[model samples]
Every structure is written in C-alpha cells, then in structure tokens.
Target: MNAKILETENVTVSFEKLSRRASELKNCFYCGASLPAISGEHIFNSSWGGSYKDKNLICCQCNFSFSNSTDKAFIIYVQAVMNSWVFKGQRHQEVPKIVLENEYFLDQGAKLKLKQPLIEDEILPDESIKSRLTFNSKSEAKRWIEGDGMATWLGRLPLAEEQEKLKKIIIETQLDRTDAKPQPISYQLNLREQYRSTAHTILKCLGFFLPEWVQGDLTKPIREFARYDKGDWRTFAIETKELFPVAEEATRILGLGVHHNSVEVYWNSSTKIVVGVLTILNRLKRSVVIAQDYSGLDSILYVVEGTHGSKKPPISVFTEFAQKQFSLPLLSVQYFSSPNNIYQYFHDELQVLMGIYYPIDAMTARLIQKIEKNNKKNLKLDQVSLEEYLNLFLSFFLDLAKVASTSVDMTKARSKLIEYGFANLAHQHVGKLYTDPDVESLMTLAFERTVKDFHAEVLNAG
Candidate 1:
C-alpha cells in the first residue's frame, strides 16, 4: 500500500482507510476469475465457534472439486485455532480488502476454501502456501512493533510520552489518507512482514499445513492430515496432542462406570493437548486408542495405583479440587513424562504397537509401490539401495504434497539415496543427497531429538 503510516505502537499492522463502498464481485474467492461463474458464494468458515461453518464463498466448478468425502475433514482442520489470536495478546482491526489483494500476501499455509473462505475478503498468502499468516490491520500495525497488549491486573506500566506518540501516529494512519491515493508502507521492523517470515519458515520445515484459524486465536500449531474419501465423519476430528494421564484420568472422573478411548501422535504440539484431553477424557472411561509411533514410547500404560490407596495419585483436576476443598494433596504426573516402569504396570494389550497408521500406511505402500514400479534400468532400486529410503521419502513427500502441492514435486525427485542401497544411502547423505531427499532430514531430527532427550535424562539423573 502507498500509505507510510508511522508506527504508533510496537505492532506490525498499521491503520489506513479508504472511503467505503460495498465489496466488488470481480474475482472468485476460490479461484480468482473474471469469467461468468456462480455468484454469491457458498462457503465454510471452519474457524468459527471452535469450528462451525458460519459462512461460504465460492464459484460452481470449484465447489464440485471439493465435494469428495475427506474434503470436510480437511476443511474442518483448516479452521483449527482460527477463533481469535492475539500475538502476545495484542491485535488490530479487520484487514482491508486492498491489502489482502496486494502482491505481498501474508498466508503461510494458504488454502482457499473451495466454496467458502473464513475471511471472505482478500487475504495474503506467502511463499509457503501451507503456513499460517497473521497480518495486522492498520490499527494493529503499531502495537505489533511495540509489542503491547491489555494490561495485566497486577502489573500495568504507564507508557512514556514517545511511546504514546508513536501509537497515535500508527492508529491515526489507519484513518483514510488526507490527500492522494493510499499505500502500504514498509520499514525494516514491519510486523506483518516479520510474522510472515516466521510463519513461512516454520511451515516449510515441518511440512505443515497452516489452517485459516491458526492465525486467528486458537493458540497452537495445527497439523492437517489428508483424507482420501474415507467415510469416517463427512469429517472426523482427532487431537493428536490429546493425551493424559487420560486413559488413567478417565477412571478417576467417570467413577469406573464410563468407557473411553484416546489416540496419540507423539512429538506434535499442534493443538493445546490440555483442551482436547479435558473435552474427551471424562467422556471415555480411562481408555484411549493412540497411534503408536516409531518411537519406543508408544505403549499404553495403566496406573495400578487405586484412587483410594496411599500409593495412588489422583489427576490434576482432583488434586487441585481436593486442595481447594480440603487443603489436601492428590498427586499427578505429566502424561508424557510417565515412568518407564509403565511397562511393568500396564496390561499386555496396551503394548508397543508397531501397527502402521492408516494414512501413513496407505502412504508408505503407495510410495514403495511407485518407486518399485518406476525403477528404470539404470536407476533401479538395487542401484540405489533405496527400497526403504524411497518408501520413507515418498511417504513424507505425498503427505506434504497433499497440502503444499505447489511447493513439492515427486516427479522431479532425483536422489542418489534412491539410486543406491542402505550403505550407499548413508554415503549419499554424508556426501551429496542430504538436503533434498528428506529421509536424511527425518533421520537427523529423530537422532537429534533422541540425543537431546538422552542428555536431558542424564542431566536429570545426575
């Protein structure tokens, strides 16, 4: 935008206004088009009310393409954490349409709703289409840089004169420009650009899909899984981060009468695990079904400690409740930080399950099959020792491709790891193929996280 609105506050968004008129119907929300298309879109704003479709915006053809079964599930996920977001708890007014349609859009995991977009107006999408983008409205620009939010009840600081002046400049700029056409200004510390930068970097590395709601309010990262016409819940919702002392938390809350189930996706902090667990933990009796991970910690462990016994410890809620009620002590443990003795404590049925996860299994199979089928004479699987590596790489690629289709290319993949076997794959990683193949990166992450944990455990033990 042409406006050089000064930074009034420490925020990224700044205010700029144009005399008002209703929205123009020139471009399609899903696919920007000038042609004769369906008017007055049918849309789904997944980020509404935890997740509800309070709206829609689309053209006819685009709507049809998104009608398959898994579409709703994916769509629901797109609305994750979209309720209302406050960067450090500071926010600005609604973004103007002109800013969204500009060359520099702010979306990281940018997916246009087929028939409806959450924010029907123009929204910015950045380099990585699968990253979450949060752009401040003109009024919010100053706060972003200043990093100000509502004053906490206990510690309120009076603003200095200069700071107050800066805030006025920024907010005043949100008003319509006095003379000529308005424009967006850029300073090195611009919040919108900086936020876009961070969001883009995170998504690209994680191969994550940024749902529309992530930037709103749902204070957490959200991971999207592609559903291939599965007849689960026109969409089904699973909180990968949802775990507890959950299976155990169940029995305590439900009084041993209710039954429960839980699932797991380790190392993913996508959504607030606390909220997801609390919502469902009591509903299901100390029971949860989890996606067993490659990591050895994927076992289900029961707390043999009875609620009434001295050795048994109650959950956080009960402990806190009891403390509040009688000034007593009921113990609890972080779900993830469970003791290793869990194997000795729980039943055999709740064991380390190497059962391949559904989409992951389906994905692995396809990747393996494709690589096997596509092996040219010179580029055979034997030549690369890549049967396993290719399988792993393709599984990850297909996953990323589903969300960031534009950023990935399986057809163009050429890895020496795919040209040689295990030892050669190792050599290739240490040599030339480490950057693009992905298997190397995956292994690196696994190894690094493992090593870090090992060191942490040792430090704790000491």
Candidate 2:
C-alpha cells in the first residue's frame, strides 16, 4: 500500500484554522496578560527553516523575549546538527562552522598548531583517536597554548637551537608535496550546551501547540523556563539514546535523508499534563513531561520516555475528571514493528490524530512483497530493510505528489537500497527503473491504484 503524502497546502490550511481560533482569544496564551498587541509566532523557530506561524498567539513582549533567548538557543542546537549528516540532507540553510578542537600535533617530526572545525564527513564513527580538544573561543585557545603544560609521549616542542633546523625540514616537506588533498582532522564533540538549549526550545514550542484555552494553564512554568528564572533548569529529565546499528549503518551509506528530526506533543489526559518529545534523526531522543496546578506555581516535572522502548520507562498519565474533558486521545504506548520502534509509534499516531495518513506495518509489508515479486527476487525483509524501503517509498510518493523532490538518479537511489542490504532485488525492475517523465506518470498511477485498493480492503474488512 502507498503511504499518504502530506501536502504543503494541507499543512497551510491546518495552521490557518488554528490561527483563526487563536485570534479570538482575549489574552496571550503564554503570559496570561491582556493582549495590548499580538504577534505571529512560529511554533518551530523560523531560523531553522520552519515557515508555519500562528498570528494572535503570543503578545509582542513575550514574542521578542523568546526570539532573543529561547529561539536563539534553538538555533544554536540546530546549527550543531547542521554539521551532522542526518540533518544536513533535510535542511537547506547556511550552516555556521563549529570549532571542534584546538591542539598541538606533530607534522614532519615538528610540533605544529591546529584548530579543528567540524567537517561534513566526520559524522562516521572512528576509534583511532584517544582524546578530544575543547576551546570555547580564540582567547581560550591562546590561553591553553600559553600555559606551561607537560609534553605528551607523541612529541615535544624543539628547543631554541633545534627550532631553526625543524623549520627548514617543515618547509622542505611542504615544498615536496604541494599536490596532495588535505584530509579532515577528527575531534570529539561536546554537545552539553547545545542539548540544553535544544531541550528548552522544544518545551517553548510545545507551549504554542497546546489548545489556547489550556495554554494559559502552562503560562507560568513555561515563562520561567524561557526566562531562565529557575536555577534548577536541569530538573527536567532528558536522555539521549543511540539508534539501532542497522539504522545507523544505513544512514552512513545513504546520508541523513533516511530519518529526520521531529517534535511531537500530546495532551496526557491520565496525568493531567502535557508531554513533548524531540527526536533528533530518530537516533537521539529527548522528552519533557510537565504537570502544573491551576496556579502554575505548584508544578512538578516527571522523567518519562517521550517515545516507546523496552528499556525506556513506561509513560505515565493520570485519569482525573477534568483531564477527561478534552477529546484528545490519551497518550498510549502502541507497539509497531518491534519494541525498539518506540518513539516512532507516537509520532505516527500524532500524524493520524492530525488527519494525516501514514503507512502502517501491513502497508509497508505489502509494498515490500510487491517490489520483491516484480523484481523476481526472493529477498528477505529485515527490520532495517523495512525502514529503508518505507522511507524510500514514502519519499517516492511525495515526489510524485509534487509535495517534495527526490534525487533524479535512479541508479544511485537503487544502489543505496542495495547497500542497505536489499541485495536480491534487480535495480532495473524497481519503481519504473528510470526517472523519465513517462516513468513518473507510471509511478503516480501505480501509487494511486495501490492506495485506492488498500482503502477499499480496509472498508470491506470493517
């Protein structure tokens, strides 16, 4: 079965409807203050390529404060991810260069100074280096170099007399090989600040998405967090988990488009709280769940898995009378392909709840079978293959629907699939083989037919 493509028009309509509802409110949703003036607020920071905005939600003062503080933090966090392979594929923004390290290294038997910045290819894992470098600014780098430190076993600086000899050797070495391409230097990443900033940004965005009537309930704590008024901001529990090996390996071969960063927020009726989760490339996951009384001063923070996993703690929600008044679905753990497929379940559920159609396991399985049969290959579909195929099929559908674009080279796309372990399938037989106008037409027809058939089957079964 074909996955439904989320059109840009549909998204615009949804936001417009929400904005209209928000405009009718008398007070700012965030500050609970009488709105002297209201401004459009992007739920996701505008700096990060997000265009969706809600006019009439935030007061002018709150909007300015958030844009400078919370939004700035969010931009820093996204900038770090911009250097990552996964996020780079999905976003088209000018990425700022990040200083990775400052260190003394050996070049031609002489100690040389090097300051490493993040390079695109460094996202892959390597075990050759033992220690990482950290320098926040130019002054920091200068201070470390000026300070008297013991030389390591790698090498020590030359004495005053030896310096002249070493300088000659370094010049001779450079003169000999001027044609070699420079290799990217590797360094360890310290993302503590970026992570903190991202977490705060996610919480603030969640506030904007909550129903306007319920938003006032969140005003106090959110404002405090945004303003950094509370010193114990770390009280909010946050954790990051590595993606499964297969998914990770596939990402390296295919680059970041295999998965993208996403934010999901849901009202937990049982707990009488709101939960928001931010998943980075579906690899690193972080969540914040907050509960506040009517006064908002008496709020409690709980550490819960924003997504599902066998190792992750079960999500908690309290079933109280007032909480049940909302018609929203109570956040529940719905197992998808496997226990490891945790956070994606809730993400997909949010899409469904928002009237967006996503491909189910059955649909994905059927698509895989069709592809295998068409290619006359007896390929075995594993968890990783399933994910890879699902992404590819979804992207193909979106491209057909004119909602998004895909790489034009069918051969390259097919090679990525094979590299990710779909070995048995014939590349020529997959998805019309060539990306010609006629091929696109055939794909569109095939996709529409499959989706129609799947809907019919579901209706008949019901």
Candidate 3:
C-alpha cells in the first residue's frame, strides 16, 4: 500500500451478506422434545366432545403417557357425570357402569342394576340342594361356566368331579323368577390423581393459547405436577365456588344439540395469578392456577367452547386490545374449603344430572327444537298464549319422558305436564310460576313418582 501510494491510490472493498432462515420448529411443552407436525393435543379431552387441539403443545409421547395415567384417572373420577350426560363424543366409548356398594351398578340411564352372575342355593325339606344362577347375558354366563363358575360355587378351586356335579345342577335347573332386596348404594372416589389431572387440563389449555408464556419458569410447578406427578397439586388446583349450571341454565347458555365443555383463562390482577376455569357438561367446575407472581399485561380472558362440530375461534380479550371493556380487574374469590369438599359438590351435581337427563335421541332432539322455536317466537311477541305455554312446557319436559328408556304413555305424560303447568301457573304471576310451596311440593312428588316408575321399568325390562 505504501508503494502504491506513490503511483496511485490503494483501493480496498468488502461485500458481506447476512442470511437467516428463521427456525419454525416446535417443541413439546412438557418433555421438551421436537414435536411432530402431525401431532396435536386436545385441551379438553375428546370424551367431552372437545374438538379444540394444539399441534405444538405436547409431543405424542407425553400425550400418550398422560392418556394412560392422569387422563384415565380423571375419566374414572367423572364417570357419573359422563354417564349421566350421555356425552359419547367422537370415540363413542361405552359409558362405564358406575360401581356402587353392595354389588350394584348405576347404569347410564341412572338405573340401579344388580350385578349379575349371582348364585343362590337353598336346602329343601327333602335335604336336596337347589341352586340358581343368574347372569346379565349369555356371553357372561358362558364365560363364567367355561372359566371358574364351579370354583365360585365350591368356595375354592373345584375338583374335576365337583365341577361336573355343578355343571349337571346348572343344566337341570329351570329358569325362574326370584326377588332381590335392594341394598344401600354409595360411591367412593379417590381425589388425589383427579386433582392432578384437573390441573393438567389447565396447563394444557395454557399451553394451547399462550405457548411461550407457559414454557417460562412460572408454570413449571403445574407442569411438573401434571406430567411427572410431582409437587402438591392442591396448591395449583381447587374446586372453585362457581356453581355448575342446572339443566335449564345449561340449555340457555349452550344449545341442546350436544353436551358442551368450556375452558376459560383469565388473569386475577389482585392475586398476581393466571387462573383457568374448566366446566364439563356444564356440571363439574374447577379452577386452576396457571401462573404465579406474574408481572404481565393484566386483563386477559381466553374462552373456548367445545361442542359437537364446533368451529368457532377462541374468544381472546387482552388489556391492550380492549382497555375500556374490562378496566376493572378480575379479583380472586376464595376457592372451596378443601379438596375433599369436591365430593359433596360432585354428589350434588350427579343427583341433579340423574334427575334431569333425558337422552336426546332423534325424536327428543326434534321435540326440543320445536319447543325452543316456539318459545323464541312467543318471547319475541312479549306474551305467551295459554296454549303456547302449556304446549311448550309439556313438550319440553313431559314429551321427553315418553322417548326415554322408560316408556311413559304419551297421553299420561302430556296430562301430567298440563296438570303441573296449570298448578304452577295458578299459584303466581306469569314470572313466578313454580315459586309457591304447594306447586313446588306437587312438582316434587310428580318427579319422584316419575323416577320411581322409571326405576321399576328398568328393573323389570332387564
């Protein structure tokens, strides 16, 4: 360069290009594994008619693991709610019969069924042994006989001769009817795993909506509890004070076409927490803390409604998006007293569901549609004609009974509906129907009788 300075100017030039192909790869939130492009995790399980899914939330391996562990436990925990709602989602798995005390089963139709394959023996005056075997189905009877029916009768492993003798007795006995005394029925469910699984649902929802936020350090406790069964789940999950909607309220909020599930995430600014609320079949409700000690945009609400053929986008509201809409911060309400209180809440919810559920088959669906249409039309006109009111009440409540598992005569059901409707209307103004004690008592007795008749019909039909 010094030598060139004498002759001409030394020239130097450099050209540099920077290129970056932004990585779009997604990783599992739980296991931190590369996620398959085809894999998706359901925020609400498919068993609840949930179609919402997140592709990058969790890897297939973690999803499968949860399915086998916490997911299964959660299903067992809500067996009664699932069976009562008749929520046979895409999988359409048979609703498992709920086990009850004293060798009984609560069927999907809320019928108390005697667990079958029963053997009763009697000693006759002639000192002869008479035995009877009762089974639910031919397959059950065959399986018992082929496996160890004789062993059961002998109270131990049976000898070859003893088995032969039992077979002869079974073959010779004729089919006859016998009375069975109803035993007290109660249920007990373990809540520990269920609590963990419930918290898992909230975590999945958080991962679904706010992937980056959920992966941060704040959500680690819940993620650990949900995935590896680590940590005290109660700190993150609790049954909230939110009351599950009754059937009428459910009908108003969610359409009658299908059982609906809902997941809502909101920030409790007062508590510096992010909370996720889950409601299934509009019956079981719980709240889970997704994040703690959060300093972020405060007002946030994310809601996803899961239903049959659901396609609506999630409703997301943020402080920046709608400052005036939710200026008031959402404060935290105290959760239920203890996790154990969930048992009573579940009991009450099950009782309500069993009392109100009428399987919505094609016929019931059509009837409900008609009633809803008529009610809407009447309400638009500001007054319901007597005929319209009576018809709506009868079709909605009483007509459904006819198409149910129990066969109540249409004429009788209609008459009863009208009778109750008139009694309810006669006691008060249009808005206060069924508010009077006498009307309520009458309705209560009618429902009790209807339930009793249904039980009897189911027992006899079987």
> How many clashes (backbone N, Cα, C below 3 Å) per candidate?
69, 6, 0
Ranking by TM-score: 3, 2, 1
What local lDDT score does residue 223 receive in model 2, on the 0 to 100 scale? 44
How many backbone clashes can be found in candidate 3?
0
Q: In model 3, what are the clashing residue pairs, if there are any?
A: none
Which candidate ranks first by TM-score, i.e. highest? 3
lDDT of 2: 0.38
lDDT of 3 at 246: 29
lDDT of 2 at 385: 41
CA lDDT, every model vs. true structure: 0.27, 0.38, 0.54
lDDT by residue (233-351, candidate 3, tens digit) is: 55766544322222234445445434666555666554678777766655566667777896644444334455564744333322221232333355445655555675787666544
RMSD of each predicted structure: 27.8, 17.6, 16.6
lDDT string, candidate 2, 209-238, tens digits? 334423544545644554444434444433
Rate residue 180 of model 1 by lDDT.
Answer: 11
lDDT of 1 by residue, 1-462 (tens): 122333323322222222111123333333444423543221111111111111122245544544342223222111211111111101113311112234432221221111211122334575433322132354454454355432321136536765676466655653431111112322121222212222221211111111221222222222121111222211222212333344445554553411121221122212212122212111211111112121211112121112111221111111111111221111221332233443343222122111112122233334434444553322422334444445455445545334222234343332322333344445544334333455434543443343243334321211
> TM-score for every candidate vs. truth?
0.18, 0.39, 0.55
